[model samples]
Target: MRQRIILDVDTGVDDSLALLYLLASPDAEIAGIASTAGNVPAAQVAINNLAWLELARAPEIEVALGAADPLEIPLRTTEDTHGPHGVGYAELPTPIRRISTRSAAQMWVDLVRRHPGELVGLCTGPLTNLALALREEPDLPRLLRRLVIMGGAFNHPGNTTPTTEWNIHVDPEAAKVVFDAFSFAPPDRRPIVCALDITESIEMRPTHLIRLAERAGSHPIETVSPADPPEARSVASNPIIRHLTDAVRFYFDFHDGYDLGYLAHMHDPFAAAVALDPALARTRPATVDIELEGALTRATTVADWAGIWGRPPNADIVVGTDPVRFFDRMIARIGDHARALYPGQPVGDPVTRLR
Candidate 1:
């Protein structure tokens, strides 16, 4: 059975991979994509979504524009971390497809209502759009079959701040609204939280990229390094491999700059995998909440694992996963899909849109 899913993302480099992962998965059906402001502006996010879909030769999927800013605070984007356009050095062709006339919030409400208990929600960006959708349809937590969120940092040092994760830090108010609203969901349906604690461990090294390219049957099996010149880009033989090489190369550069080695913490794609098969991750039930008032801990995610507050668990926080298993699965699916799309390909053909 194909699982129907709606992806809400900021389209960061990792988010791009997550989208491609879903596109490659045989049993996953992308119902729609919501572009939220985070890694870049909402407009560019929407463009990234369309461009990726076009690159993957995927079926027409509805793309919707989300709010320009968060619920309360001004928008904050991580261009330095994800590159100016959110896709690193890879230049995707402009998509001919247009966005849906409806807003992202409306799209969520309509999709869930239309599918009832058949839809699964996957969010890989700030909670802004989901927060907005909740305002119009408060019963969203009950309508969907499951929800998987790639945000928050529990017991892990924050990547954005000493105590905050990037997505939640972008809009703490929106995060709070989402966590609180979903508190009413049934325990079995608690949102699966893929916090930084587990996601940062799903690292993507240069070797993994090489494996992916090799599996795709792309010639020259590209490899990258921190010692390489900053301006270097991929000149791989396959179009998808070339683009992915360039995109992830930028990510590798960013991590090396932070002394985290030339590897990327693939946060979103892991969440996408968990959305497809929860067995990919081991989770713990917890009463999750967002911190909005702390001067040093604002946007921090606090999980009460021991029922200290006596509240029902609103989230199933991911705690463990075998990184090897995930990397193998990713390489197999994406590499096979790319090979089928552009078998024995040459260097990226003068970038152009599909007819």
Candidate 2:
């Protein structure tokens, strides 16, 4: 049976990729998409969400705009990372579809209530929407089949600050509320956190992007001639691969600046993958708390890995993943979707598909 799921996103580069990954997966039944403010304004996030669904030809799924800012903190956006439109270098045409009138928190409450004990909530952005839903309906934690979050850096250094990951840091209070909501839930109901510790381990270098692009029958390099404009080489007949390659180029550029060798971490996609198939990564139970006020430690996800805190475990933290296998699965599913979308097109290499 296909997993009924809702994606909570900020619609940035990685978030967009996560949407694509889930849309391409046969096991995922995307019930809805809830947009939050993190990578850009909530409005832009909603736009990106609708655009992606339209591109994937999955307009039947609902899309809703969430919080414009965190519960108490001033909103901060990461336009530098995701570009002005929150989709990096790719430019998506405006979608004709309209967002649902219901708020994101309302959508969450309605969807879970409609499919009690059968819906997975995959959050790849700030926890504001989830927290709001929890406040409105206290039983949300128990209703969800599972919750998977792509935030925090329990054992690894943070990508935003020395001790805070971007998503949680964007809204610590919201994160705290969501974590506390699950604190008393059963182990199986607690949130599964795909933190930076494991996500950072699965890096997609240029070669991987090249392979994905090739699979879509798009040229990896736009142009080899120095005289030709850089944009000329990015033209691809496959819209899906074209958009993926263009958006990834911006991400690759950002990582290159960090001397990471043009590699982008598969953070949100890993979380989405785990939401669809929990066995993709190994997890351990741990008590998690978000630091609300510590000057330099605010928004840090403190995992009680040693059991000294005496607090009940609130989250299952992912610690390991098989990069090769994970990528193989992801690429194959994406290729399958592309092929299904355009039957006669030359979908690139079949090696990954064979797996």
Candidate 3:
């Protein structure tokens, strides 16, 4: 049976890749998509959702826009990472599809209630929407199949600062709320968070982008096309390539001196992967606490209770991943999706897909 899932995302460049992976994976039955305010404004986040879904040609999946801002703090935007349009420097084709009138938090709560214990919440952005849903319906903890969050950095240093990932740093209060809400919930009721350290280890390098480009070939990319050879004549174009290329390029330029530049870590995708295949990850049972009031450590997640303040490790921390197996699975899946969506190129064999 396909795992029923509701993806809570911000539709950033990475989020777009995660969405593509979710829709392409046969194991997941994507119930819907909920947008949040993090990488960009909530409005644009909603707009970007339509473009991405249209590109993936998965209109059957509902797209709902969530919280416009954090629960307590003022809205914060990240133009540096996602750019002004919220998808790096690339411009995706504008999708005419309208966003669901229902609020994101509402969609999330209603879906969970509708599905009862069958829905898995894959959150890849700030925790505001989840927190809001929990606030509106405190009993939701018992109904969810699970909560797989993509945020936080335990032993590893944070990306945004010395101690905070962008998602958590965007809204520490919201993170605190979500973490605290399920901290003491029964094992079956709590959420599982995939931390940054584990996620950063799974990457899609520039070679991967080149692989996608090679699949696209000389044919223009933007619209849907039928399956064919790598050098086959084009039926339509694929738009995701240009934007994704620019995003990867921007990412590469930003990490010029670091090894991270070789590949862009699909942090959100790996988190979603854990939800689909728990075997991809080895997790440690512990309490997770988000520090909110710390003068300097605010928005940081701590697993153990030391001298610092953090929520109890209510959620399991993913510490290990089989890099070879993980990469093989991911490349195969992504390569298939790229071929299916764009058509042409090497459809089989990851080893020769890029060549």
Candidate 4:
């Protein structure tokens, strides 16, 4: 049974990677994509989403635009992290199709309502769209089969701030709303948070990129200009892998600044993987709260790991992952997709085969 899923994203580098991973997964079926404001503005996020779908040749997936700003705070975009256009060095052709007429919040409500207990909600951005959906449909927590989110930093230092992760930090108010809403639901139905503790464990190095490129065969990277015709833009050599390679180079450079070496953590992809197969990571139940008033700890996710809070566990927080097996699955799925795209080309083995 293919897992039905709706992806909500800010369309940054890692978010784009997550989209590709889903497109490749045989067990997952993307119902739609909802663009939100996080790593970039909602409009740019929509543009990135449309361009990616076009590049993937996935015209069936519809995209809808969400919030332009957080519930209370002004929108903050991380163009420094993801290049000016959200995707790094690689420039995607202008999308021929427009976004869905329905807003992201409306799409979320409609899809879940239509699918009932079959929809899995995967969010890789700020919680604004989900929060808004909850406002429209209060029973959203119970309606979803599961909600997998890529955010929060429990016991580890954050990439955005000392206390808060980027997604939660961008809109703590919306995070608070989501956490509070889910607290009232059953533990099994609550959100499965792929926090930094687990996501930061899986890293992709240059060797992995080389393996991906090799699987894509010896295709020359071509740059498309605005004057180029649609067919010319579409016939690029291994466009998906080439774009991924080009964008990841920027991310690798960013990680180098933090002395994290030449590898970048597979944050969003791990979340998407866990969503497809819950057994990929080990999770523990915990009561999560977003700090709203702390001067230094605002937006921080407070997990009651030791039951000090005395409140029942409201969320399942990922704590562990087998990096080797995870990478194997990732590489295999990517290799499979690359082979499907270029059937005549011989795709060599991935960096590592599934164990």
**Candidate maximizing lDDT:** 1
Q: After superposition, which runs of candidate 4 have C-alpha atoms over 4 Å from their true positions? A: 218-236, 346-355
TM-score list, all predictions: 0.96, 0.94, 0.86, 0.91
lDDT of 4 by residue, 1-355 (tens): 8999999999899898889899989899999899999998999999999998888777488899998999999988888888788876667889987999999999999998998889999999999999999999989888899999999999899989997899999999999899889988887798899998878888988667665656556244233222322222222247777678667767766777678877778899889999999999788999999999998899999998888988888899998889888877777787568767765654443342111
Model 1, span 29-56: residue lDDT tens: 9999999999999999999999999988
lDDT per residue (tens digit) for residues 1-355 in model 2: 8998989999999898899999998788999899999999999999999998888888488899998989998999988788788877788979998999999999999998888999999999999999999998889989999999999998799999998999999999999999999998988898999999998888876567655655555432332112323253256556787777667767766776677766788788888899999999899999999998799999999999878988889999998989888888877777567656655665443332100
All models: lDDT? Answer: 0.91, 0.84, 0.74, 0.83
Ranking by TM-score: 1, 2, 4, 3
Give one clash count per candidate, in the order shown: 0, 1, 16, 0
lDDT (0-100) at residue 278 of candidate 4? 92
Return whichever of 1 and 4 wins on TM-score. 1
Model 3 / residue 27 / CA error / Å: 1.2
lDDT of 3 at 296: 91
RMSD of each: 3.8, 3.7, 5.8, 5.6
Give the residue spans of candidate 1 off by over 4 A: 345-355
Error of 3 at 334 (Å): 2.6
